[model samples]
Target: MAKTKTQTATPAPHTRTRTHRALLAAQLSNSVGDGAFYVTSALYFSRIVGLSAPQIGAGLAVAWGIGSLAGVPLGHLADRRGPRGSAVLLALATSAAVASFLLIRSFVPFLLAAALYATAQSGLAAARQALLAGLVEPGARVGMLARLQATLNAGLAVGAALGGLALSLGTRRAYLAVFALDALGFLVCALLLRGLPPLPGAPAASGDEPRLVVLRDRPYAVLTLLNALLLLRLPLLSLALPLWIVQRTSAPGWTVSALFVLNTGAVMLFQVRAARSVTGLPEATRAVGRSGLVMLASCAVFALTAVGLGPWPTVAVLVLGAVLQVVAEMRHSAGSWQIGFALAPADRIGQYQGFYGTGVPLARTLGPLLVTTLLIGWGVPGWLVLGAVFLVAGLVTGPAVRWAEHVRSRAAAPAAGELVKAN
Candidate 1:
């Protein structure tokens, strides 16, 4: 992709239109429920539902795997039937799944409910993205996404606190209440979505075109894979860092909570600002490239924590690493939003967004095992290798995006000529 002319001035920051407010409200409502569930779900399953830890983990793994496969078809449904309706329906389905969890006692019932939950959530995400793309201007979509991210973190924080209260009580009633709250949140989300302005569905594909056209788009597939690789960072803080702190560093276990707080608080405060300058594809790619280098530096700093430093010194170094990591995270997120929306075919935005969104679940599913093995099992060398992986993935994103653009341009050329002749 040759450099496109950059905007000379920064655009005014995104203001909360009614649609924006509705979207943010829906996101916050559901995320709060999700946050509470995240903190309580494991114990709920073990203590209340009588499942073994291994059983819980295996069931969730299978659920998300199936969810990942279900996204594309569900997103295609959004394109054919309108995004707002699809999103609303999926939200209700998600609520139903959460409600079912209250009745699930056996492993098989838990697995089935979990799968439904995951699938509905995945489809809901894709439909929401498609709705965002339709309603928001191209230039402001990233800004809107940044705001949504901030709202999500805020809601999660509040939900986590509520979940902590439930954990303190440690009763079956308390656990059930958390699940009930989560289900209610999704119900509210659906109601909010129902009020949004409807968007027309995409036109049907011509007879010659495949029904699932995204499956055949090789360049976009490559882009999605590269993005997924960069997303390995998703589990680093959640899964890998706590283990690294406890086993590898002199830092106290409390440092894990501190790091989590730092991450969520920083994102809530700064994510929108970090995304302000990413006005177009060129800027977006540059931001992604910069994020890679920053992530590499953070990784290197983390590696230093294992060098027999005093506890305070390890904590200080870990804090610095975390700051760098969060900065990288914000920039990468901004750039990703830009690329994901810009490169997708306008008519097929629902399916394309669904496919692109798969990177999240993929990262979540595979990242823990991979990151833990590299960081915990291999030690310092693992950190360095992981940094290199991030660096390469970030650098490769530029080429992958350009390849996608080139293919899109080539595909559009004949269409333009045919229009010219018809005129």
Candidate 2:
């Protein structure tokens, strides 16, 4: 007694296309409001709440580290149970954390709220990405991912602008309002996900696959490791770069906020075309490699900002660095997502997403400490060190990409399929 491929399969077209779009829109809304909180929170705590910059950075690093450890099990849970449930819980947790800002203005309470928010961020990211994979046609995943990222950056720009506006309002109440808006965004995102048709959970099929099986896939494994380094450079830019500008270049806090606005605004404008440029590329591995190169170049720009440029020149350098960072972010996000979707079994997307997502949060945990420490000890020289680390890490991962190319080539040869869209 034999089984047909179709009969043995779980299902085709697990959810409708519009459902995916709804999820993406919700994500964009959440990111726009949430993004502002991170950049501004550090500043607010340091300048307004009366903490030292180093102390604030250290606290964030510790909170992020704790959240990263928590994410693994949460990811696994999303895989076993369902992301819809997780998404709802995430929304609730975020709401509570944001509201807690009003009641407990101390450092310890802030740390607890930050940790909770980070955990929610990790869970939502994994669940949303995995859910999208289930809902979309496989060939369109990269484009969808880019669109998702572009939406997020756009939302971030809006959020940052609003936060800046709140600062101008000059009251604790305004700040609390901003946090409340962010919480509401999370709630909206959860509601949107809940309305979508059921996405397949990891346990329903291929229940025998162990978590470690993903690690055996060397190409993916290697890329995940390299991403750990890439993720570090961004926070350096987000947290450290602005601080550097304000302290060293005679710029105000507004100047730093303006620079971020430029960074995110550029992504919103150019991300679509950049995403399309590699869409028909031959191999996913090379596409991802190209993304690495873009990132390497951007890190160089960021490292040079500490050399004491005049105000406009400083802004220009910051803009250039931001441009490269966003470009690289767009490309890397697309390619990495493509890789995740391609490597995942149709049945267990949640588990794979959980494993894959560990890189970004883990990088966040480590990057701030490294960049802050370097900045304290050596200023501009520290950024050079950071840039070098990213460049070397990216180059070292090339061999694994080559492996992926070889594997994909074999898979495509027999079917003579059109090349999958490049990320």
Candidate 3:
């Protein structure tokens, strides 16, 4: 709250000359399906299809791993063929993959279905991000991203409620109905993309440009790695803290639900407002650095929960930690958006965004194991070490992004000289 007091005024979404109401509407529709499918996927496989827990888990792990690897290539495709058309085609393809689940039963079929779904989902995300980059001005990007996050939360709530209603019916037909609706949602999203302005394919860069620019950009790679670490904040809230409360802390179990509500509600209310002040690279990097400090403070507070306090005292500390982590998340996310966009070459944003997108699914894939091991295995010392990690990473972000900018400038200089000499 104190950090974002110096915000530049940004236009309201409705006021912009953009017809992104369709895009926002598409995100809302897609996210609702995501929430429902995610919540019901395991149940659908377990109860209706009769697959065991370990079977589904292994398949999903493999699928997500494969999908993460595909992001770079698929993103390159988007750059070559225009994100608008690629996004539409991929979204429709994803819809077909989702509907295929109705026939999957055993391990092999399930694995194939999961792989197809996961790959399409990852590609769609990269395409949509690239599409968004083409759709909105850079200055307004973070605010729009913030609004999308908020919309996702709202859609999740609605979809979760729908899933609950479906679950209460306890029939195979009921589960199938949810799956069908989720597929339909994607189809609708594809239709929505058809209405957006055409985004022309990016022209190939000069032969002097590195063949695989994103892969060779070492500084951006480091920045991507750091962002991956910061993304651990998600698993901390979703996976680790809940289990920690049950296993280690004296806090009442209800704090789990309460803390999640706090995190979600806070983001819904404050994320866009917080992102407003971060309109450029310098401010973006500072916000990223501050997020680390806030995260460190949050971790320290969470560690206090294990200090043999009464349940109420423990609950208070847990809530405070939750609040701080959410603030840290909002700050870091805004910074990430700014840096990611500003650093990418305008023509190859899709490829670069795909490269950056790898960090997220990779983090989601690995974070659960890492955080649980550190927090649950080493206890308070572990939490302190994690805080130090956040502090160091956050503080390093600005320098790293600036260094990346310098590298880009150096890379472009020779090309500029070549063109002048030819003239």
Candidate 4:
């Protein structure tokens, strides 16, 4: 008599627990480095590396574009090989890429290094998501992701302060030190990943299963696009709001930094709580819908700042808007995690997550231009349109998710019947 699946899986509670902690620790370590790198990279390139602003911008844009295309194949590699090893290798590659930046004195070297860094970061993200899916129970993945988000925010805050210190020093040595710190962080991330239990590679694809099944997944692709639209919020605070505050509103210059601090602090404190109630697809969709409404309200509040308010009044309005935006950000993040994980096939989690993760780079690439144009060039009406976009995307998520679920279920039915017949 053979045992059922549960009967054969009773001894790994402790291992799972350790894997969870390891994932959180790894996220914190790398995110801190990313924070410092993001804050100082432009200055380092211009002041120390002798690169023009346009050159640096072009290099990174091209790098992330290449990275977006690389994610699917690399994710497929993770699925065919093993996520742990893939993740470890990619982390090391990322560290190497960052180190290369320190030595790059020309445009070509910077471009190559930046591309490698982007590709490795993209692949590492996909592999880690797959690893998390393998190690954690399906029901708990969202909560775990929320905790990771909180940890990431906390780490980034600390790293940002360190970056600020380096910026104030404004020396060649200080800039080099920040880059070195980023390299070291990724190195540490690689080591932490190496310690995790190795998961088996996914079984070989059958003749019917295409190597890149995710590419053929239309419903999942639709959801991915919709999620990408929502992710336009990525540049809202960083690019749009700052410009809005500086050019349009009467808020003090420091209000921009204050708003950023408010957003990060709010996420660190409340993200897990925001995610706690979102346990399934229905809840996830609802959370997203609610977030859109809140985001719309926040947009309205931000628009009010343009009406010739006093400095304190403008600051107050900005803070209120920032608070609302962060709340929406937290909820949208939680819901998107649940949807991305739930829609993916268990065996193809790596490739699926990799494809899903493209939304980030897509947002990064297109979001600044789109957000700045809408929020700054178009002004109040633009805010309304942006809010409407969020609202529509959130509203449509439920139907899109249902479509994906239906397709996935339909695809699974034949396999289920085949299993039953064999048994």
Candidate 5:
């Protein structure tokens, strides 16, 4: 599980170019599969798989709750080994897990696959981020991450459309295809990084220390909490959206595909421009706050669909809400990028990412249950609650960003040569 540690002379111009191309290609493939899989799962579970909305909600909660716990161990592995090895192994395992879905059709086995998939996903993502940190020139880090996000968005746009089209073939078959594509993407990623220069990180940092020691960092904790809140809303798109389309809207299933298509398009178009405009941590937080306001506004629109709006109008409202939510997601993604890269200790990037990732899954676990309960009881009220959560997230994130800035300034100001590590 160790990486090749051989270092050559500084990477030549052609070498950097080749590596960048390889990484981009791999990312595009991977994200296409990711987008396809998520949308396909939503359609399959809600429509063909015979799971009720609440059951799907519960499954998502359990799967992500398990994922939250799995992050620590996965992080330790990545830190102990190297990013390349971790990413490759996890990618292969994920492929197997996805393939298993074809064999096992019951709830328990499907749940097991979900947990395994989440674990593998966390590992691959952490390794990939770490690898980027390891491989790119320091000056290029910001652009590199931004470019990666943008590329992911592009893949998402294409994947969603393709997955939607596959749905016409039949749910089980479509999902199988999604998994196959994901498997192929991982294989490509593994091949591209296998022989590249090894990532250099700081010495091993133990994660077994008291949780409080890490938790006491108020800013990081707040950031984590807010992220969790944001992730909680994911079911809106993942579960709620498809359900709404089939049960409520007269729009064809094709419309569901179109919504995702638009979401990814927004992300691809706005991400780089958005990142460029917001240059620092505080700025990014403010942007998230503003997007939260937009999300808050959009929720009312979604709620209206349940209020007897015609199919066309409901479809329009749904699209508007999705667009607003994606904008907020873009803001959150940008801020997360800055927080994760800046706050993580040089030697313990995987652990820090693991920590950050835990919050999102934890939030997702709770959100589905809470929202589902509301959906059962209050209907449109549930949608409103999601909007409220985002509002709170935005408000809380503002102070968290300020606190991080304060800590960073105080630590780095007095010591000129040293790196200021946020725990």
Candidate 6:
């Protein structure tokens, strides 16, 4: 996306600077391969490697856990070192981890490789976000983030198509090709980073070394936790909705694909427009609150799906719900980018971004279990409760963010005074 926003809200692809365009292109390439490999991984493990579905799940869960733990330290490393170098290194590590799947014949090796992959992926995300914060101005960062998200959706769609085509080939080697494709994309992305200015490694003005500033800021930590739950929207659509449609709702099975198409299409077509209002933290907080209300309505509509009105009625309600959910998704994501950037100290953004990014792996890891228990287990009541959580968390964000900024300012006062005295 272009740095300038007003007249052309959605900049043409050619308008962005070379480094900015390259980063966005790398995002698309990486996500395409991820989309393909993700679809194939479970089947490959079960059919080719002789591992059960649960074993595959266990390995992935463990990997994500490891990834979460590794995030902060790696991010701190990026803050000290250059983010450009760290991002390139971890991207290469991610490629190696994906390629290791080719050697997997048993469970132990698979688990080890997966842990490495997940950890490297988490570190890569932290480093990349730091890179963005350094390269992009604060005023334009959230918009840039939304534009990248749109590219990711587009890339995933392409990847999914390719994966389906490969599935038709139906050979073990064909599945392995999917993995190889994902690895190659990472290498490409790493190479692209070589052209980026070593932006993340901006030299820090002398300030206290951060051991765990993010953790100590209780309000900020709380916001991270709440945002993590709000992100359950992802699992709700990708995993729970399909299961709910099949078992509880009277909606036709194919409706699931329709919902995915609508959500993906909305994100690709309108994510930047949705982000325009969120250029700063106050606006972002409002957007988040608005998203919460949308989510509440969507969940309530979804609850109606189980009433069994008829296939068409169920389809209507489900489609409506999906549309609202996409709105919520767009608003929540844009708002989050602003909040994360606003709350982080400029000098320690790599560490703070790393801390903030943890919410993703943490949410993705717990989201399935949470969705299954709340949405699937209890049915209607579960949906209502989920809606309530969104409502509360969304509204709470503004106050929480204000309080975090207060704490951050208070903490910085002593240092400022000390500098003044030295001068």
Which candidate number maximizes lDDT? 1
User: On a 0 to 100 scale, what is the lDDT of residue 65 in model 1?
Assistant: 88
Better of 3 and 4 by lDDT: 4
Evaluation by TM-score, superior candidate among 4 and 5: 4
For candidate 1, write residues 35-136 as lDDT tens digits. 899999999999999999999988988898888888888988998888999999999999999999999989999999999999999899989988887778
Using Cα atoms with residue i matched to residue i, what is each candidate's TM-score against the true structure?
0.96, 0.80, 0.92, 0.96, 0.81, 0.93
In candidate 2, what residue range of length 10 has the lowest lDDT sum? 1-10
Candidate 1 local accuracy as lDDT? 0.90
Q: Candidate 6 has which clashing residue pairs, if any?
A: none
lDDT by residue (1-423, candidate 4, tens digit) is 211121112227787788789999999998888888889999999988899989987898899988988898888899879888999999999999999998999999999999999999999999999888877888788999999999998888888889999999999888888889889999999999999877777776766658998999998898888888888888998879999999999889999899889988988899999999999999999988888888888888999998998999889888999888999999999999999988887778889999999999999888888989998999999999998988888888899999998998897798788888889
The Cα RMSD in angstroms, rounded to one decimal, for candidate 5 relative to the true structure is: 5.2
User: What are the per-residue Cα lDDT tens digits for candidate 3 across 328-353?
Assistant: 99999999988887898776777788
Candidate 4 Cα lDDT to native: 0.88
Q: Which structure is stronger by TM-score: 3 or 4?
A: 4
lDDT of 6 by residue, 1-423 (tens): 111111112344454477678889889878999988876788888988999988998899999999988988888778778788999999999999999999999999999999999999999998888887777767778888998999999988888877877788878989999999999999999998867766535454335544656767688788888788789898899899899999998788999889988998999999999999887878989999889999999999999998888999999999999999999999999999899888887766777788888889887888889988999999999999999989898999989988887887897798778878878
| Model 5 agreement with the true structure over 358-420: per-residue lDDT tens digits | 866775677555666655446677768778877888777787877877887786575544434
- In order, the Cα lDDT scores of the candidates are 0.90, 0.67, 0.84, 0.88, 0.70, 0.86
Arrange candidates, best lDDT first.
1, 4, 6, 3, 5, 2
**Candidate 5 Cα outliers beyond 4 Å, as residue runs:** 1-14, 39-60, 105-108, 137-142, 171-177, 206-218, 242-255, 304-314, 379-381, 407-423
Query: Could you give the C-alpha RMSD of every candidate to the true structure, in order shown?
Result: 4.2, 5.9, 5.6, 2.5, 5.2, 4.8
- lDDT score at residue 1, model 5, on the 0-100 scale: 18
lDDT of 2: 0.67
Candidates by TM-score, descending order: 4, 1, 6, 3, 5, 2
Q: How would you encode candidate 2's per-residue C-alpha lDDT over 1-423 as one tens digit per residue?
A: 111111112244534556657877787878877876754666667655777777676777777777666665666666667666776677677767776765655788878877887777777666766567656667666777777777888788778778878777867777777777888887787788788667545543345645535556667667678767767766666667766776656445677667666667777777666666555334555656666677667767766766777667767777787777777676666666666666665545655676678787777767666777776457767766776776666566557656766876786575454433321
